[model samples]
Target chain A: MSPTPRRISTSTAVLPADGRRQNLSLVLQTLRRLGPTSRAQLAREVGVTKVTMSDLVAELIGEGRVRDVGTAEQAGPGKPATLVDLDRSGLLTLAVDLSVPARLQAAVVDVTGTVLHREERAAAVDAGQGRGLDPAVVVELVRSVLATAQHPVLGIGIGTPGLVAPDGTVRTAPNLGWTDVALRELVAEATGVPVLVTNDSDAATQAELSTSPASQDMVLVQVGRGVGCGVVSGGRLVRGAHHAAGEIGHVTVGTDGGETCSCGRAGCLETWLSVPRLRAALDAGDDPAAADSVAEVGGHRLAVALAPLVAALDLSEVVLAGPAALLEPVVPVVARSLADRLLPSLDTPLTVRLATSPEDIVLRGAAALVLWDRLGVV
Target chain B: MSPTPRRISTSTAVLPADGRRQNLSLVLQTLRRLGPTSRAQLAREVGVTKVTMSDLVAELIGEGRVRDVGTAEQAGPGKPATLVDLDRSGLLTLAVDLSVPARLQAAVVDVTGTVLHREERAAAVDAGQGRGLDPAVVVELVRSVLATAQHPVLGIGIGTPGLVAPDGTVRTAPNLGWTDVALRELVAEATGVPVLVTNDSDAATQAELSTSPASQDMVLVQVGRGVGCGVVSGGRLVRGAHHAAGEIGHVTVGTDGGETCSCGRAGCLETWLSVPRLRAALDAGDDPAAADSVAEVGGHRLAVALAPLVAALDLSEVVLAGPAALLEPVVPVVARSLADRLLPSLDTPLTVRLATSPEDIVLRGAAALVLWDRLGVV
Candidate 1:
């Protein structure tokens, strides 16, 4: 009951290599969270000696990753402390979002998580023609974005809709008609920059965590053309043994059959909860009662699917990311269903809500992937 | 995808204090895994300098937790290194399992996970009489066990059937008829030994993990009087926000009406999966078909409840711990159900099996609880 300690593995010791990386990551994350701070203050906050802190800060400055801004005001102090902070705008990351229907979106983001430049292009390949987005087109877009970066570019991060392998291979993405596409290598080869690729839901999860760093255990259900989920447990993404941890779209929710899914399964969560399906129900010409019933049914299916997860993980919240109109009504129903299914606990009441920035969550999450990969800072 | 790195929190830096504890834990674990090891070899295996390893080993020997066990045979070495090993029989742990129906079981366990002495007593309290296991009875058992220890006792660990809080309070144990009982405080005060209390299933999870230490993401479903689960993700026990992460008994499996549960819910997983219900069905004369049907239904219900969890966590295995006769048939049904629900993956195929040591899992897990809490080794 004391927060369960991580199992100590055979190689659990922090060797010198791990120590340096961990310390560097800690310093960067502390600066990102607390803004600017003096070396002594940073050392105290990071639980390191003043000498170690100074050495790490100097290393960061030497690498042009951080800069000493100015001396702090004296408060009956012996020496005016110099404040060190991240060079937020000096480094950039190119992020691409290929999950949007028929559109390719890319952005150049800085270390401060701000988008410096953005562009959109209609995808050349068509899903209707049984062709996925062309790798050449993605490579071309990466080239265009890399050329626009005024500062040093860290890497390219792509959040695509698919079952992405750990090696940045798209195992299969029915929506994009892709199978085993080496997106990372393809883009890296053409653009000559390092690349990181992940499932769109995973990207969105990173985006959500970037905004709410306090959430250690939460699930973000992204309902786009398909319904998928991103799971964060103990402040780390739950990438399952197969890198399919949150592939819940095909999971059959209930016995009562509804529409058939593309996977030839009836009553899949996506069949009822996908944005397209929900929008269709809502756009069914002002039949308020009918639309409400559709939303209610979708909510019930989602709750049935999520109740066990909520119970198993003791999740703090479930964030819905998609069109607000379709998801707003579904939220209360999911909340009610979960309440009825799970044992009532006053101490940790579950929260089910819509995402704050659903529109650009995947895009920003792409940037987050680059930050984590290149800088080891989330 | 490359095994999602653990999020580096602002305070993630390994301080000098953390470094020492982590190194000690690592050395102890390595020795536990590799058996009697020399200081030089241990230093190499633990990624520490020879001097540091010697210091740690000396500290451990001084505490009488480990002993110098002669020397390792030299092969072209400058010196015959002294081998240090855990003093397995020198220290003992008093473990109690209150989860076994109508009985109180306790054991004296050594550091090497051997049960040196075991005892069982018929519980005085009766669930049929609307009285849970009495606190006085448990305290008496602990006192008796304390007197039987042949060596120095490290602590007392209790695996109770209840919703245990982080502070070691039994929030509620319907089976034990306990609520808001400060069991840890009671036992520690009576016997003056440090105490650790956890839910029975959680303790069983620890036991399973002891036998198979490589299982990082797995769920152990202990189906005894009622259904409950212990989830281990990222090599840490998933104690939910309210310490109710694996309370899955009341989760409604399907819409089909079944036997009503004590919670007044129809179609709860417990209604189909509890040992009592399955035994009753299996004992109904030579109706093999009916018994098979019961097992099949229970298995299907379990699959429905677990499908989402498996999908969410990307769990590698689902270990069923219960009566083998009843659970053996449930295994295949669960496998098939999961196969139908989850996306088929060749790389990380899910494994469904029964726990090898089901009868005494809770008792052994109680010992494991002490090992983790007192020694910081698991």
Candidate 2:
């Protein structure tokens, strides 16, 4: 199914001002997708009147967020209408990814999710030191990224590895040594820019959802430093009561309670399925044979952890986000494991694929968060 | 958390007609919960002008779905305004529960989900004979219940155990020996009344959600003749792509691949958690020690199956639907098992409780389905 924007999809009554904003949002989103397009075509696609479309486009142009570029090629129409497109060069977004291992990654991305510039800085926290990324270091990184942006910065979107409240407070990030850090407020106050703080898994899931419009319901498992998952059900992000809905890493999969985890628990899914563990297990074995065996075991374990979720949510697809060498070997194992467990009534096969949004999935996801917040596009 | 209705909550733009219906739905839902209320109070609660509220109430009264009673007692000031309420005596709904074992249970429920009348018949199906409930038998059961209704029949809502499509087609109900059954069409045609067919678990979940608005995200595991679950995520039923989202019965939980299930799966959750198997296990035990031991193990297994789901969806509650003797002993066991597996960030403890709906959850759920479909109340 084509991705349906939440605003117009469900016909509900709205005040005129709210309705106008919704129409403008629809117009902006369509322009992002279709590039330069005639007002008439844009209006038709957004199911709005041409007059309303013109007014919205005019407003955007007046705000210097959109530009009219020449005229469209018409076959035998009355006139060649002028094409309107987003002014990509007019605005920039400072997107920061604090989920990277041992590093804080930042990027200046445009409204189109195109990374305009990028930078990376070594984070201050060390794993054995029992510390996490310092809030000051993260702020410094954001400042560095903002300084490099040539265009006007719209806002800052930070994708962190932690339980993030909707208001952008970091409840806890074990690896980052952070707890109750009002990251959004801190960043916003320091830089005088609007800010959005979200879990890395959720940001990645939003980006994945935006690209794969066909599959509205999916679970994206990030097997990086930890084994967290982001769930998109019924075309919306399933943020739980405490904003930890998709934090699946700590859920125990091993019945034996094998290894103690950072959370003071045994047999956490992360202890077995995280990238570091998988790599270590492979390294402990003899070259190819050991890696293959480790992959199979890890895949089977992942399937065990995900089967209940797939069955419970009736998810149509599962995507793995990690190095291909690690993820590819696990795909078939997970697929076979799920096939054996799922009900026959679920006739439609659950497709397991890798994330398709290039190497900077988390970075792009951070940018997408800003897009969603500003435009209501997602 | 209070249950937030979808409409107007997000402040998104809506078309006039849709906005009107949404407002109307809000008004009706409020009346359903609050009983008779003055229009000014309702207008204030719904955030609409008194003129709009009066217009909406007038339209509903014209449709014979609402009525105005005499004025309320005089307050300290001006005259009391007339009160409006749902026309409970104006229409009735026939709710059928075909999920019961060898029994087709039904009721004549009012708008408030009050069972005015009820009837049950021996469903024409024998598992030993490999025969299932005939569609004709279900239709006849609905007609029999409709005959007893004193008010105008609003429609028929059938809760069946199977994969139901949005249009009410039963893709497959293995226990019912039904495949590709146009159940809604069959019943609708027979009685000349509108019909809705849904998975019994989903219906039960809806009813559970309707009554318990505080906990919007929950899982209701119906351990009756088979093991099935209904998921309520983001305050709405999580109906899967094939309408089998919560069909966890066939999802293999045990690694042993123990007994072969009716779905041709081994070590399925149903093979271990189904009511029949649990009862048989208790029956085979010579004493309470053995029975309690079996219950403890079963509860652990159920917890293992649910831990991943609880983590993945951040579900706050799990409600078990089964005989108290069977479910009560399992609750503490399940809780202990989950406590060992779940992450600490999920600070809000997961509560495992028994179904509070008396004896006929599916029947009430069937009524809820109609209420939700017609008034957008749920």
Candidate 3:
């Protein structure tokens, strides 16, 4: 079902009518954060009366969202209280990503962001470029994953490389030759499941933001088929007015002529940092020094483009979400470039790190969208 | 007093315990947004019961935060309801700025963001480097402003440059030569008034975001003594992890060493776009063509740094907040530079506009900080 997308409020202030919903959300989030815990502990943590917490727990249990997982060992209390936690196996989320180069990946995940079953297939390549991939292929992948899901599926999420509308339409994806594709509606109609569509980088950002010890203000740059970015500040993804906020791949990096971009622009960051472009540049010459130099140049260019963002947003961390082989060398160069330009008085030094298996990050983020939208898990 | 800095929650969800408070905040915000209105209309607009709204109104009136402003004219056959609105004259806010070059400016403003009085004094400059201004002078300015306030002061807001801690400490302001100064505590001690402190650019961004039809995702670039940016996304200011978000001055724009910056870096955006630098470049050559060319180059350099941010954050607007003489010439140049690089498929055009009287914008924003913190007005 194509549920209407609701705009996320920037203000963190709670409302009167949302009191019960907020409390329920807090309980669920706490259960996810703290793992198995007692109702008394939850009541204390959530600032609710024990009786009220019991009621909330009962409602969650009835909905199959939480389960009573035995009792805590008594240390000093007369009676040990029953420990409850999220029912990880109780629900499933289907996530798919079309942003991966030459392949379409899908996964069945649980409410806790654990991938239960994963699948992928190579798309028929056209013209040596990532193009002419059929939208029906994505729809089929969602259906195939749904068939294997043993648990009740909460929703289906699709992350693609493009500007996505709130209503889940792909406004444009030059690499995939997709424009105004109603991929969300097609998948939902074929599988009869709730579907969410977002730009792949935004999905990856959401996944990163949901991780433990997550910084509320961070930037996740996914350097794969495209060199896009996702920004999270004040705990919300910055979906631009045109829903093209993370299209850093097309940002101009040089005035001199370079390789042409998919968006018809020359000298774009994508031209310099895209996996295919980097690979081609590496393949052009066999000398190790040349390769190292190329990697350094790529990293330096990326840093130059990103340093302004780091400063403008006061970002806590910059994550490179891509293959280690391609992004690892670039990390040191990028770090050095950033240090060279960034103000030296940085007390909490801006961290630059390589994300673990960012290929699946967008898929997980797609699942997170379902969790965030359907269950308010975030 | 320096209230402990409260961390902003990324989640927009409301809480159960905050029901009454949220309702009160909504009423106050609605009154401010919609102007004077009757309790029945407010109840209908806020989706609260008339009885509950009446109670809220009574509480607000009793607290002198709202006032009954006569009765609405009855169009239908019913008793005229009493109109109520925010008591604009009930509270005053004192705002100060250390971000201004060679001066400490302060203002006494009403709750409605109306400036009632203003004063400025040149700070003792050191070696014409825009440094050596003592934090004690800022404290004295706040005291002086507080002395002249005609109304009951809600709080004092100070907007300075460089990194600011949540506890109102100026971590480092190379321009002002401030380091770990407890300006908030000092002002509070000197005047016995509640105080809030923040980066001046952040304050300006807040003021801009509070304007009519404000875009939630916007950037305000203050091009003054030092070039810094203030970012607002999802309706909240993005104060980074180190409280140094929006420090864009040192972001390197070129390889050719121009002027060494106070931060000991060369080829910074500040070197290219700061008011003093541009003025010097203009005064160095009297040719109008050369001045236009210089302005264009400065704008292009700024756009190169900012385009990535625009693409990364999906910002809707980029505001140049500075003196018209310096910023006006750069506006069209910045717009052209951005237009040349930004993807052509953008549905919502990114706007570049000059801010109206940016010097006062920080002062207003400081007042806004007090409003946001003390009254939850934002």
Interface RMSD of each: 3.6, 5.7, 10.2
Say which docking band candidate 3 falls in.
Answer: acceptable
DockQ for every prediction shown: 0.47, 0.42, 0.37
lDDT of 2 by residue, B1-378 (tens): 012123232423345565566667788778887889999988887777899889989999998889988899988698788999989887578899988756788899887678889888886666557787777777777788888888777778889987887778898787787878988788888998778888999888888887777787889998888888998887778977666788888787745556787777777777677677678878986787877876787788889899989888888999998787888888999988888888654477888888877377888898888877766665
How many backbone clashes does every candidate have?
A: 3, 4, 3
Model 3, A149-170: lDDT tens per residue? 9987988888888788887888
Ranking 1 against 3 by DockQ, winner: 1
Instruction: Output candidate 3 Cα RMSD.
Output: 5.5
Residue A262 in candidate 3, Cα distance off native in Å: 3.7
- Residue-level lDDT of model 1, residues A1-378, one tens digit each, is 344443323344565555676788888878888888899988988778899999999999998888999998988849988899998865688889998746788889887677889888887556668877777877887788788889868888999998898889999887777889998888877877888999999999999998888778899999888888999877778887677888888888886666877788777788878787788888877888888888898898899999899887778889999888889999999999888787776476888999877777888898987888877777
The DockQ leader among the candidates is 1
Question: Model 1, B20-117: lDDT tens per residue?
Answer: 66688777777888889999999998888899899988888888888999977886749988899888866678899998757788889886667888
Ranking by DockQ: 1, 2, 3
lDDT for residue A42 in candidate 2, whole number 0-100: 90
**What is candidate 3's lDDT per residue for B316-356, written digit by digit as tens?**
88888888886788999999999887775467688899885
Candidate 3: pairs in clash: A10-B234, A14-B14, B1-B194
Candidate closest to the true structure, highest lDDT: 1
Q: What range of 10 consecutive residues in model 3 chain A has the weakest lDDT sum? A: A1-10
